[model samples]
Target: MKVVEQIKAPILDEMETFEQKFSNSMSSKVALLNRITHYIVNRKGKQMRPMFVFLVAKMLSDNEKANERTFRGASVIELIHTATLVHDDVVDDSNMRRGFFSVNALWKNKIAVLVGDYLLSKGLLLSIDNEDFDLLKIISVAVREMSEGELLQIEKARKLDISEAVYYDIIRQKTATLIAACCSLGAASVQPNSVHVEKMRKFGELIGMAFQIKDDLFDYGETAIGKPTGIDIKEQKMTLPLIYALNTATDKDKDWMINSVKNHNKNKLRVKQVIQKVKDLGGLEYAEKKMLTFKMEAIDILQQYPNSDYKSALELMVNYVIDRKK
Candidate 1:
């Protein structure tokens, strides 16, 4: 079975209910807002964030009952995630997302900005209305971390000076924090002990770290995964592979690599050369090893829980994190 299919199988009924609740959360009185939101709902991605929320909640809950708080938790996290994506498209100046025109592309920057804000408010209000303050705290921290990560990356990108440690920090905040929040929210939704919530957060963080590393590795390959190869290089984003290659390269080769990224990034041949050099220098191997380390660590955490379909699905999701092509 597909990764999503495997992960959602155990939670199929709850997922349907979650979908309805999610749509209701996105509704608005304003016609234009409603139309845009309807479009967003129609063109939604895999809903992986909410799935994580539900799966972890089920896995950890003593009674295994997906209560109203659980549904609200999923809805809140999904709203926050959607808001981030809408805002990200504007920030990236991208015209498309998930194979469709981005909100910014269709509605212009101002409207897109407002729509993102609206979604964010909806998420906050959901938590407040449902008194899901624990979930609110978790997601709010993720939001703050995400903003910091983006700004830090932008600052480093201008000078091309991201170290390996900084690279990890950036990815943790930019990508992993929200995923961690999803898992933590899942545990919290079930009213688990603080220990369980913390453990799930750590597991999610490890998987998320592996996931980002896998995505960074893709930049050096020729695989067609929506974006073109060397796009990260062309954009001057210092991923793990390139960072590793640069650290181990000879001074002359290092200067060449740095200069190419700084000046010749727009040149297709130069980008390909950088990609090739990264591979030749064992960058991909290093990244793969690190990715697997995190993946294993995440799996080890799951071993503490009793065996169940939900636990098995969570394990599948960890494997899927490193295995996904895109």
Candidate 2:
């Protein structure tokens, strides 16, 4: 099996636990909760956040007690991640995700929005049961970061003039914050040292940053990961690669891209032209180099931990950021 698949085996067990926790707490006899759960399972995201929690726990303490604590932590992270996706689809008006209809696409915006809230509430309730106040704080802060990230993106979306720094800040909060939370919570399960916790958090933040950059770069590539290539451009949202390139591009190139991106006309050629210009100006390559640097930084942090399969796996996951085509 591939490395990603290998890392997934333990996380799958935690996902089951997350489901049971939610199912037992649910009050209504309505099938709505079941339907929502089923939709989430069918979507089957890569479960990266959970893996971070598990891996960090394993590296910190290779014991059964640590394992169980890590399992619960991973479950919380996954729940939080799923809730974000539900809300994201509604916000983006996206019809498809992971090559299937989004929950919003099938159930409409109102249901999707409510279901997202339900998931978040359920996650909070489950978190409280664990009585890990520190864990709860970590998750709560992550949710706050996620919201701020979304709001920042929205504000930037309204204005066509997005700076490279602003775009990266948005992504860091939106995507990296939760991953960093996972690492911090996981480290807390084993080590109480603030230094180790900070290191783990740094590791997660760097890896998460690389992951999102790769995702944005994938948009411009002709790969399965590039499915929503022109979506950001069409929606007039500036991602990191575009923002960086625009800052560096020749005035003519920038003008062409600005006009094409701002245009609401359904001319495929216009989007293509901007994409070509982006590629020609080395936007994708610059992003790739940055991703490599982040990945390396993440791996460097792992070296402080004792060598183990768990540590090795975390190192491998760093490379997987660039390797993952989707």
The C-alpha stretches of model 1 lying farther than 4 A from their native spots are 222-228
Best by lDDT: 1
Report the Cα lDDT for candidate 1.
0.91
RMSD, each candidate, Å? 1.6, 2.8
Clashing residue pairs for model 1? none
Best by TM-score: 1
Residue-by-residue lDDT tens digits, candidate 1, 156-182: 999887899999999999989988999
The residue-level lDDT of candidate 2 at 128 comes to: 85
lDDT of 1 at 250: 100
lDDT of each: 0.91, 0.77
Q: Worst 10-residue stretch by lDDT in candidate 2? A: 19-28
Per-residue CA lDDT of model 2 for 208-255, tens digit only, reads 899888878766873664553666677677877788778888898788
TM-score of each: 0.97, 0.88
Q: What is the lDDT of residue 69 in candidate 1?
A: 87
